[model samples]
Target: MTTQNLLVELFVEELPPKALKKLGEAFAGALADQLRAQGLASEDSLVTAYASPRRLAAHVSHVWLKAADKAVQQKLMPVSVGLNTEGQATPALLKKLAALGADVSDPAAAVAALKRAPDGKAEALFYDSLVTGATLDTGLQKALDEAIRLLPIPKLMSYQLESDCELPGWSSVHFVRPAHGLVALHGSTVVPLKALGLTAGRSTQGHRFEAAVSPVVIEHADHYAETLARDGAVIAGFEARRAEIVSQLAEAAARLGGGVRAIEDEALLDEVTALVERPNVLVCEFEPQFLEVPQECLILTMKANQKYFPLLDAQGRLTHRFLVVSNIRPEDASAVVGGNERVVRPRLADAKFFFDQDRKKTLASRVEGLSRVVYHNKLGSQGERVERVRAIARAIAQPLGGEALAQAADTAAQLAKSDLLTDMVGEFPELQGIMGGYYARHDGLSEDIAFAIEDHYRPRFAGDALPRSAAGVVVALADKLETLVGMFGIGNLPSGDKDPFALRRHALGVIRMLIEKDLPLELDGLLAGAWPVFGERVVDAHTALADFIYDRLAGALREQGYSAQEVDAVLALRPQRLGQVARLLAAVRAFAALPESPALAAANKRIANILRKAGEVDPHVNPQLLQEPAEQNLYQAMQRFVPEANAQFEAGDYTASLQTLAALRGAVDAFFDDVMVNAEQLDLRLNRQGLLKSLHEAMNRVADLSRLAA
Candidate 1:
């Protein structure tokens, strides 16, 4: 099993910058995984993924030139079927032997050599053979094909390449981009293969304009990255290139001498890194007058449209100076700096024009235009959706805040979607809520209303921040609830990771807000309020929606480090106040750690099963019916501690409440050990069932202890 590090590179036109990181990782991972599965690479083989604007590559350490030979025993037909009663080979066995490349001239001899093994209920004949190892050339070809097939390509480009054959022809090829070359090396020797109409070679093209030498030759499998860097003028690794860009941005910003720093956006940084090979961070500036526009608007245009990093000052305001990642670094870099500055000026001017034009028509005036904008074909227009959201917002606001907050929320919800009609938002749909906030302020609205308008879409994704203002929280809740209830009601529920409307995200957002904000709002009541807003347009499926939200909440809690049993215990009750779920989970954890938790949890499970079997058992206990000592002792324990636990529960001390029950573990064990819950005497049986019912209720006030049962 002689081994050498392997390197494979696919050179193409510039990849989709945003998708490059994922594509590169998928390519390398799929290649390594397939190789390992085929026994061409060991489990500990290290894989280094390389991705740049023009290429995706991988360097796998300790890959075998040929997979180890394996001994295999393949099952044939049953012994009875393979051999006749005379112990001679039958026609079926002779045919099978021929197919297996065994000599069938002597059928009896062939049948005698076959081994017998039990397969299911019958003894079956088996063929024992050794499978030859796969050569590196063949295995690498299969791996290369598999890796290309598995790339997470954002989009595919279909193109034709000019054939180099004597017979003139054009070959059609489809890939993430038009792949010009491929490099596959095993210790400096090119692995003979073909992919995407190109033959494997040791040479690959580098940065289109900055390569020190054209068609840089990779000297060895281990030297692929270094050779490309020195001669091809490319940084081959995605993370390495990103880190370099970060360092350059910092250094370039420091030279400006204003306590300025590049805005921290890892996604933006990655995209910029993928857009350049040899990144030359240059400080470029625009006219300071453009600062009058919203910094968010300017910064977004710069990053999204131009792929530039906007610098921020100490005050957290946008600075005129920004950093550009130039692919080529020429002496006296003034031309590159000037070109980027000149290109950004027009983009900034467009954003400024949109901002100024958008402000001309106050958000209040844009309300009527929203009716023409469709939110959903079945849910009606944006105007109707706004009304539904406004209604839900006001209903939510009454409990979150007083009439003042209600008014603010109503205003914000009504105008939140109006920005869709604005030029600025139309140009950049990502700035929908953002531009609305600006317009609200321009209309001389209160700060609370403006902030609420912007923050209503808070927590757009996982781990995103929630709304800042009370009014914003109310509106955000309303908006999310409206979507959930409406979508669920319409029977357009999410199915298997296909949430076209991002309903999962909305559900998680609601859960995060309720749990993190510790809002006093009940989940049922909120759904009840949001449903009527849809009026006759939707069915009453709020129960299903509640279940959906709770499911999301349970998963989120588990992700936050709670065990499945802990989550199940707390969520079993369907506690109306979602804010209390965290406390319930904490209480469950503390109770689980108790020394007596296992016994108590098991007892609780038994009690639940018994109760479920005994239909409609009253919890009212008659002390005189407790003839057994174990029952009497458990009754006395309950009488003493049930009140204490209840009191703690009422006082919101859930941990204390669950902890007080730990003292009753011994009595519970004794009762279950000695007492007959289903005695022959009806009175005794009913009374005993009643006693267990009382115990069940008290133990499960915070969470269903039975669910924690093993």
Candidate 2:
């Protein structure tokens, strides 16, 4: 077998750097898939990708030459027809010959040719074959042709050339940018590649800026990447712009007085990657006064205006200077620094204005302004949303200590959206909740409530943080409920990856508040109560959003490494009690690792098994219904155990709960060992089931202990 290297390079007009990065991996994976589908990829086949803003390329090495030959046979359809009474060929049957493009007079030969002569190859000699040409090497052109068809380059266009070669439109792949051309070659020789109608070649180009226009002539496909690398391109295969930015940032930070503190900004990195060819860092300073205007606003300015990485001091505090990454190096360096600083000035100045104006207006006064601002096109305005949230806060407050929590939540919600209308948040929209916290404090809200104002947006990203205080948790839940309800009312819930309303975030936030904050607020009741105040105009707003937030609970738990099976088991019993599910999950996880805990798990498993058969159990399972001695014994044991299991679960002492629940194993096992559930007497069977139900019911109060896996 001859070893061969295959290379295909798509040279296009400047491509979006971020797009190129993702597209690169997609290209490689797609090509490998096409090879498998075509029966070409083999044991040694592997695909590698390389991308730059101007081009995306992939190389397939040691790929199988072509689909292996297989013996072929075709089955002929059986035809049976008869004439009326006389058993002769009828006119209808005779006329069918013409429809089949055959004549009755000459059909014998055609029929005979399709007949199988034997069970094996003896049959092949008899049947005529419809053969497709096969080659040893799959080569490169068709692979590229498949890539072009499946690549799905966003904002794609068509590239038509008058080489007089014929191909279908879908196969004649074009892109958003002009493809300077594609070079498809196997082992440096032009392979017989055809689909998009181009054969393999030995030539490629270097970096658009770094290398000369003269193509980097290649000797072999194996050397294609190295050739380009020698021409000042690193083609190990990823986004060059991002790689360069990270590399240059690290180098630059090491040279600075301290490390370049990385501020979290993936979105900014994506946007800026497209704006550069090569990334270089330049440290620039802003006025110290700008730091006072909220680090969030200043950082956003640094990222938005300058595409810079913000720096942090030794104390993890935002410094006055930021590191701006430019695509091209400047000769007069000071000019670039001045230009970025000038551009960011307006953004920071706007922050200062929002702070001052908001300071002048009491946080309490902002409540009235909320009513004036529209919350949704159909769900009234900010004023209406505040009203709904105030109601929700009260609904949730009862579990969190009704009146005090309610007041705090109501105050926070009243002032929450005020910052949205302020100059700073309007300029830096991400500062909406942050500005609210600032004004809430100035207006005399207690520290807890003011922090709640800011923290309502807590954990904007997964694993960020849960609301820190009871008030903050309530308001966060209220805010998320409003967003989910408002958006869902308008039919804007997340479907797959298309969450236009950020409903996933709202739901995750709600779940975080429920579990981490341990708010015992019921989702359905809260939404139902808030609907009259907020959901009157929206369609199916109550249940729709309740179910949506519930779904997010599963997702949040899954992210923490919970199994789908475990989630299903817990959710099956108490779907809405997200905090309860979390608590039970901990107990089960701890119990599983305990060597002595299996007997307890076995007992719970027996309880769950019995509960499943005795379906639709009442929570008020009658202990008095117990007729058997075992039934009476189990009821007393469960009565004694419920509080302890509930206490362990409540305190998050899962290990303790496992011990407490396991303690009931002896009584549970004894009851099952000695008892019969479906006795001949009706009252006794129901009583036995009621006894088992009591055990299941008590354990489920903290968790469906029966749901615990052995």
Root-mean-square deviation (CA) per prediction = 1.9, 6.3
Candidate 1: clashing pairs of residues:
none
Q: What are the per-residue Cα lDDT tens digits for candidate 1 across 1-710? A: 57899999999988998899999999999999989988899999999999998899999999988999998888989989988898888898889889988888887778778899899999999998788888889999999999999888877889998897899989888899998889999887899989999999998987788788987999899998899899988999999999999899999888888799999998898889889999989989999999999999899999998999999998899999999999898999999999999999999999999988888888989999989989888899999999999999998888778898898899999999999999998899999898999889889998888899999998999878999999889899999998999999899999997999999999998988888899998888998888888878899998899899989988888888999999999889999998898788889999999998999999999999999999898999999899999999999999999999999999999999999999999999999889989999999999999999999999999999989889
Can you give the lDDT of residue 537 in candidate 1?
A: 88
- Model 1 scores a C-alpha lDDT of 0.91
Model 2: how far is 468 from its true place, Å? 4.2
Q: What value does the lDDT take at residue 452 in candidate 1?
A: 90
Q: In model 1, which regions exceed 4 Å deviation?
A: 162-168
Angstrom error of the Cα, residue 26, model 1: value is 2.4
Task: TM-score for candidate 2, please give it.
Answer: 0.77
